[model samples]
Target: MEEIKMNTIYDNEKFFNKYSQMTRSQKGLAGAGEWHTLQKLLPDFTDKTVLDLGCGYGWHCLYAAEHGAKAVTGVDLSEKMLAVAKEKTAGYPVNYLQADIATLTFPVATFDVVLSSLAIHYVADFKRLILNIKQYLKTDGILVFSVEHPAFTAEGSQDFYYDEKGNILHYPLDNYFNEGIREANFLGEKVTKYHRTLTTYLNTLLKNDFTLLNVVEPTPATELLALPEMKEELRRPMMLIIKAKNNL
Candidate 1:
């Protein structure tokens, strides 16, 4: 993936601040499943120093603070995102910093947990990112994150079509296990995302002095299943949750 820019509306602090506020108005971000997912990860957070990478608007950071975390620090490439994060986290036990994830400069061994949710895919230099995250996590510290499923985003494996029964089938428009770099959309435009097989991710985690503990594939919610158009693919993975612990 190349160094592509974020949408200007999302790049500027003023615009991003409003953008985030607007998102909160829409419906839900940490809707039920996410709330429960966080509950499942609670052991990783209690009384811990947490670093939230790509912490868009500080949603998880704020949640961490509310959950008895000693402190939560969030970092993001967009000053705007960070700015809004700062505002959103005000009066809470969380701090927001503006920085690019690919070149983060957190002090070595500084965090008990380095977590990210739905954000790491934006990094172009993912290998370097894997290495850098090690610098901040304490030994036995965990790296827990969620991202778009590689299988769903892979080239030939990604498609939205129908079968003989007229039932919708959303399968590979490309290979499910290819080293492909593609882009996802943000407000009708494109942003780069790397598509790697699960083995690729596992290998990278292993090479970085970390061990995989779990991989959770969240099924679509009841609301999604209730939608006639989404029922066919309800059993499919909508996102992937990965958990690992640093051994170094």
Candidate 2:
């Protein structure tokens, strides 16, 4: 088993430069494939304190602040990513922190809402992270997060199986029951991601006293479907979004 340390993969100059060029990095929430669906699942942010784990470029943090969140704290391990987040965030009640999502701590009942966008899959211990989230959230606080779907990670390739003629035949899936660290190639580099079954994702929250609200296997935003490549998303679920409440 490869030990999962503080993940600073996003800080690598080559990887950071390439990631900075992604549509999501440039256009914020509008460029995210699942934002259309995920946004609908979020509770109103009015006057709420928000904590965004693995907050990347802090799009969600800014959105919360812009929409009346009392305060927003965005945490990520990459100094470069945080630098960009801070540079773009001005006159908004948003704070950027350079910290590891797997070990960062917050006081109890510290926030009214907690969010993570496509980032939790990198943490090695999902249960511990959420347990801390449960403790940090106020009573009835909302938690919304999205991650790369297990089915997409099951095969370790995070890609499609193509035919001899070069058309994508299907997304390959195997070793699905075996969940753990996966070495996946992303942006032409080996990236480390953790895989957990859908059941584990839901059951962990249930056992930890979270009331399940909704589970989404999101498709590309409707407008994105017009793009030739986006249409392929219909064939497989690449992301999972979950909304839950602290049932205290």
Provide the RMSD of all predictions against the true structure, rounded to 1 decimal.
Answer: 4.2, 2.3
lDDT of 1 by residue, 1-248 (tens): 23335523368444444454542323335442444554475454688999998887677788788877998889877766777678777897888777777788778999998888777766666678888889888889888888777766676324457899977665545566556667664433455666777777778999887988888876545654564534644545546788899999
What C-alpha lDDT values do all the predictions have? 0.70, 0.89
Q: After superposition, how far is residue 119 of candidate 1 from its true place, in Å?
A: 1.3
Worst 10 residues of 1 by lDDT: 23-32
Give the least accurate 10-residue stretch of model 2, judged by summed lDDT.
1-10
List the candidate 2 regions with Cα displacement exceeding 4 Å.
1-6
| Whole-model lDDT, model 1 | 0.70
Model 2 TM-score, all chains together:
0.95
Over the stretch 149-191, how does candidate 2's per-residue lDDT look in tens digits? 9999888978888899999898888999999989887877778
